[model samples]
Target: MLAVLQVILLVLDIVWWLVIVSAILSWLFAFNVVNARNPVVDSIGNFLYRATEPLYRPIRRVLPDLGGIDLSPLVVLLLIFFIQQVIVLYLIPAVYRAGV
Candidate 1:
């Protein structure tokens, strides 16, 4: 059970990084800092979009339009942090201390 919790935590950490990368990549593409037409760039952008958009889509719906700014990734990162804190600070200790 503890091992499973640790694996979940690791995945969350990875996804948090993914969200950050996706947001930054979008900004780069928008600002023309990177060539959107490049095969490498397009492939990476597509991968990130596919991975993160499912999670971001619902958050985007709940959030109001902010013109060009997107806050969904930040919100998702915060939620991930909160979940990590809950598992590490509460769930893991409780389970271990309880001899489970």
Candidate 2:
């Protein structure tokens, strides 16, 4: 059970980094800093989009438009942070106390 919680933490960490990278890559693409025409870049962009889009879709539906600024990534990151904090601060300690 402890191992499972640890694995969940690891997965959350990976997702947090994925969201950060996706946001940075998107900014790069938007500013023309990276060539979207490059096959490698395109592939990476597509993979990131596919990985993160499902997470973003629900958040996007609830948020009002901000005039071309997307806040879904930020919202998702915050949620990930909150979940991590809960696991680390509350759930882990509770598990430790329960010895399971």
Provide the overall lDDT of each model, using Cα atoms, as 2-decimal numbers.
0.95, 0.97
lDDT (10s digit) by residue, model 2, range 28-73: 9999999999999999999999999999999999999898899999
Query: Candidate 2, clashing residue pairs?
Result: none
Checking candidate 1 for backbone clashes, the offending pairs are none
Q: After superposition, how far is residue 30 of candidate 1 from its true place, in Å?
A: 1.0
Alpha-carbon runs more than 4 Å astray in model 2: none
Highest lDDT among the candidates is held by which one? 2
Tens-place lDDT per residue, model 1, 38-82, is 999999999999999999999999999999888999999999999
Q: What is the TM-score of each candidate against the true structure?
A: 0.96, 0.97
Worst 10 residues of 2 by lDDT: 1-10
